[model samples]
Target: MQDLLGHLRSGQVCYSTPQGAMISGDSLELLAQLPANSVDLFVTSPPFPLLRQKAYGNEDQQRYVAWLTEFAKLAKDALKPTGSLVIDIGGAYQRGLPVRSLHQYRALLAFVDDVGYRLAEEFYWYNPSKLPSPIEWVNKRKIRAKDAVNTVWWLSKTDDPKADVGKVRVPYSKSMERLLQDPQRYYTPKDRPSQHSIGEAFGRDNGGALPSNLLSIPNSQSNDAYLRACKALGLSGHPARFPIKLPSFFIEMCTDPGDLVVDFFGGSNTTGRAAEDLRRRWLSFELDRAYAAESVVRFIGDQAPAKVLKHIEQMTNGQVLAIDDSA
Candidate 1:
């Protein structure tokens, strides 16, 4: 296994695990080196195709689709037959127009039609804290509603990927809780108005209710350890950091502890940190060397981790970042 992963660690190495490695390089080049049928869970939020360009590179609409489709083929090869690839993609607006871009929609089609990956399910991420986007049309013109939702596509190698909904169930609603308390009174079996039958076993406690495909999570990070550490080192945090909850939900649902997780476009390495905390081995690739190096700060705890300290030294050219009590 180590020999197969040699190419993954060819670039600047920030961290290492039994089945994980973090390398700094273009993901397009790095992905090819990974052994086929190795990764169990692949997750990432690549730079969205925006009307205006972001500092981090993002190809224009049609080109982005072509690039992503080609990359999807490589991503599929890196995954096991029963593995899943969960991607969080945001919608884009047409240049200087109120109309929406079909790039995201077309990308979805290419994933199925071109790449042959099955769309297991589509999830929506509602970021309550998201600021108004496409400011011209949304705020100035007041033509469209606030663009606060992102599409999360769950694509799998096969019809059934390794997923367990029970692993990511949520707490039951108050009505369901009351029904569980007294099945005879509140939970009698009956045919519902929606033409759905309520079975007697519905009252059984299955940990919690299965969460809706739509996820409500805020992306704001005020004074977390990662931000504190980055601030102390004068490193601006990754502008587009996905909330930890977003990846944690899918990671729990699609993978088990010790499974392999890969983030091909590892901006700030949020997916890597989530996998680490979940005890799942992870491999990550980032194009930006500085961002890749600064990502090690996510590992700092109460005390500085020796591994991260060493990585910081390399990233800063021997300027060790102090992961003191502030973080």
Candidate 2:
């Protein structure tokens, strides 16, 4: 366990790059070096135990929990009091049995509880193309109940967790007003006084509906992106990677600009890229040296072959940003 903050205080420095960098090492070991309550948010989808043929490496399911338990402890120390931890877990099946709905939810819930984290919310990300299960009824047997959903569990250290609802608002929808009349709706707001209208209040201006626990972000380009990286870098392995949008959304919802973010199991460094695009600092730790190198190239290459543009348009509106080329 490295005391990274101790070195920072002792004036023993290494890399000085302003942009976020990916470090090659085990996340558990690297997390020990980070300062207590230093990060604004922690987000990552650790490799689920015993999910065969997955991108993440395999480990004994029981031992995996122990490793994850330690990781959770280190992550707790890394988060600021106001910060949050959003974990995306892939469900697992019973060994050699076709137990379709056997998710690790209960075990995970218990693990987080033991680690002193409070369960805040559970999001169900419905992916229409969810992997099919063998033993249970065909997931696609129903029209609306297709094999399409993942879990995004939210956890916080304290009761008064800090979140920015305004930043996470989605585009407004006129149709949502219909729900306002429903008194039984869970999110019904008092302003419109109807369940149908409650969603309209939180919708964003981008024309998309307000974000919900069931995020519809497609797993696009990630597989191809990994294949491309493997080929271009001449590497033998292709790790399962996530898109930048997935973690970026949570970072914006949970943290402010210039805050620190950490991902111990950074497969493709999507978290780091999102932090940079959103103007936040980040530090990622990956065990695979090849993946780490590829991440650095992918992150830095975008800065090159790019032209610096400035906005000279004069508008009285509050949203127009004025850019001075010096920055």
Candidate 3:
């Protein structure tokens, strides 16, 4: 891991494990310094362009496309020929109006048409636990339904990126399981109204059903270890953190073990933790030193609150805390 990231000598290493490291610095500068074509997957949930500014900071709707495309241009050069870049961006409503902003779509086009990235695929993340937002539209006047879906753009440097749907398959539905049990008796192989022919291959159980583009993951994390550690140390956790499942899904599908994964906007370092668990080398960059230091809680297991606090202090004081996995 050190050999791969030794070039990043400028940024302060907040902490590190055998698999990856968390660095505190400007992501744009850090990203530029990375060796060209070294990263396998660059997945991140950048701060959304919302009507109200978030504590973590966000680009306004007007300049959001330009701001994000700058990063995309750099990431394109950093990615390997067969690498992938996955971005999870939430939709926003127009100021004082119920209409939705098209910034997300515009950014997508800029990444492909301008920055030379290919549109590998698009995904919609449905967060069932999301609360009804823009209360004036959804709760008070009831003009628009609750915005529960986020646009996840999967961009690639080349036409043929490294991905395997089999790696991230879901369990078969109940009806499908029944059909698989007795294909000849329960179902007939015939052409459907869609003009697609059903063959004997449908009966074969391929471990699990292929997952769809629409991912349903709940983001209701209240008592997780990261949060608990933050509470114990009297530090506020990063406000907007996507669930672990979101990054884990793409990590499993897009890259193999030992592949390099990077998240530029590493809020709470969720992507780093996910990659470490999967045995993939990762680097997470966050601008705020405090957040980067506090993120160490995600890696350390069941240490005393005082010990965790001590580690965080060391990181905040520009000391590198090498994590002992055996502990």
Backbone clashes under 3 angstroms, per model: 0, 12, 0
TM-score winner, 1 or 2: 1
Root-mean-square deviation of each candidate, in angstroms? Answer: 3.4, 10.1, 1.3
Model 1: lDDT to the true structure:
0.80
Model 2, 107-202: lDDT tens digits are 466657688887777877655544555424455333222345667878887766678656776754555554434434635445553544444445
User: Rank order by TM-score, top first?
Assistant: 3, 1, 2
The deviation in Å at residue 278 for candidate 1 is: 1.1
Provide TM-scores for the models. Answer: 0.90, 0.72, 0.97
Candidate 3 lands at a TM-score of 0.97
| CA-lDDT, candidates in order | 0.80, 0.61, 0.91
Best by lDDT: 3
CA lDDT, candidate 3, residue 292: 93
Query: Which residue pairs clash within candidate 1?
Result: none
Worst 10 residues of 2 by lDDT: 308-317
Ranking by lDDT: 3, 1, 2
Runs with alpha carbons beyond 4 Å of true place in candidate 2: 1-17, 51-55, 100-103, 129-147, 174-209, 222-237, 301-327
